[model samples]
Target: MVEVERLFFMGASQSSSSNSNGEVVFKTETPVQFSPTLVSQLADRQNASPVPTSERQSTLDDQIRAKIKDEVGKLRREEEAVQKQIHTALEKENLDRERDGAGELADGTDSGIGAVKSSAALMGDLEEIRGKIERFQVRKSLQDWPQVRESREKLVECYRSHKASSLECWKEVEGFKDSVRTLEKEYFKTLQ
Candidate 1:
């Protein structure tokens, strides 16, 4: 469709208007039409640009990674808590057995570690620890059995010296967990 806009300038020649030679000159009216297609094309050009879906997806992926990392951090913290519990347990068992003198009793306290014969779950932990101990043993970190025996004697001496202290330590490491994994990294290092 043709759209016309009119602007009137009345009395151009008769109103003392002059030409380049200061002489009156007659002029005719001209028509101008606005093009709808050109206007629509200009607007469409702006809208035709691509959307940022890839950029948006990258932002979403980053958010997902951050959420996963947060969940993993929480799980790691829980795992550490469980390990500490196990450490305290083994330490107590070590002390009690020393006191009561257990030659070969198949303690039923930890069904997870039945009879010290390497039960399924405990065996895996034992194997992992054995690897670490092998490395530590190479480095001479863990004491020999004789030295451990001497240390056990000293532990008893300390227990005798302080009455409630041994029991206190036992309270922290109850159930004699019976798992080789009950040692913390630092204590395992000592075993090497």
Candidate 2:
């Protein structure tokens, strides 16, 4: 039989020993103790009051609003600075224009008038192009003329009738070609 004893750092002790009959016995000493300050601090923590949910929520809301106000103020200051810079640049440009005797730079109305003139010119150009396109669409092809159409039909009929002897259709072919040439000459004359 063997006997063993153990001691813990927190002031507790455990011992095991064999009795005369070979049975084991265990004994434990006193539990760990706490300093007075530590005990008082733990007691104080247990008794401390907690903030209510509504009060905590309101404090958080106030903090968020303060942050938003700070950010908006920063943005407004930046915007004002930018506006001042633009005004200064415009004033400098106007002074330069006055020195050059260019009439202190034209206002928005003058530029608007120029824009209207440009738009009117663009409309005129568009109208001219449309007229040209209409005229081209209206012009008749030589094949559509009455004399040319008649001769072409005759030539086609003659070729159909003289399938194996296409030479016999020479007269009709020559007549069709002559009609086309005449129409072409008239079209060119009209252009001149």
What do the candidate models score in CA lDDT, each in turn? 0.62, 0.77
Q: Residue by residue across 55-132, what tens digits does model 1's lDDT show?
A: 898998999999999999999999999999999999898777654542345563444423443245457878999999
Model 2 residue 3 lDDT? 30
lDDT of model 2 at position 54: 95
Please report the TM-score between candidate 2 and the true structure: 0.31
Clashing pairs in 2: none
lDDT by residue (94-189, candidate 2, tens digit) is: 666545532222552333232423335658878999999998867766456899999999999998999999999989989999998998898899
Q: Any runs in candidate 1 off by more than 4 Å, and if so which? A: 1-52, 102-192
Could you tell me every candidate's TM-score relative to the true structure? 0.28, 0.31
Model 2 residue runs over 4 Å out of place are 1-135, 138-144
